[model samples]
Target: MAVNGRSRVPTRRDLAEEELMLDTYRGRRYCKQHPSQQMIPLGVADVCPLEHSAAGEQPVDQ
Candidate 1:
C-alpha cells in the first residue's frame, strides 16, 4: 500500500532489510538531501536551509 506516494508502515521483512542497511552505516549520519548518502560522521547534524510549513490536519487519535 501507499501513503502520500511513500510506502505504508513497513512489515517484518522490510524492517529486517532496513536493519541490515543500518548496520552498514553503524557510525555514519544520513544526508537529508540524499538519504542514501551516509558520508557524514555520527552525531553530526545536517543543516537544512529550507523551512517546512506546518501540516493543517489535526491529530487523528485526539
Candidate 2:
C-alpha cells in the first residue's frame, strides 16, 4: 500500500512468516503481533508500522 505517494515498507522476515501462517488458515488465524488490527488478507502486507521502528530500522514515510 502507498502512503502520501510513498512506497510501502518492505515486509520484515518475522512479519512475512506470521503473514504466511495467517494466510494458511485465512480467517481462522489471528495476528499474534497485532491482535487489534484487522485481519491482513492474502497479499495485503501493509500492517504494523511500529514493527520496523522497534527493530531499529528507519521509519518509512507514512
By lDDT, who's the top model here? 2
- Model 2 TM-score? 0.25
lDDT accuracy of residue 19 in candidate 2: 71
All candidates: CA RMSD (Å):
13.4, 14.4
Cα lDDT, all candidates: 0.53, 0.55
Q: What is candidate 2's CA lDDT for residue 2?
A: 63
Tens digit of per-residue lDDT, candidate 2, span 5-30: 99776669857877788668654434
C-alpha RMSD in Å of predicted model 1 compared with the true structure? 13.4
What TM-score do all the candidates reach, one by one? 0.32, 0.25
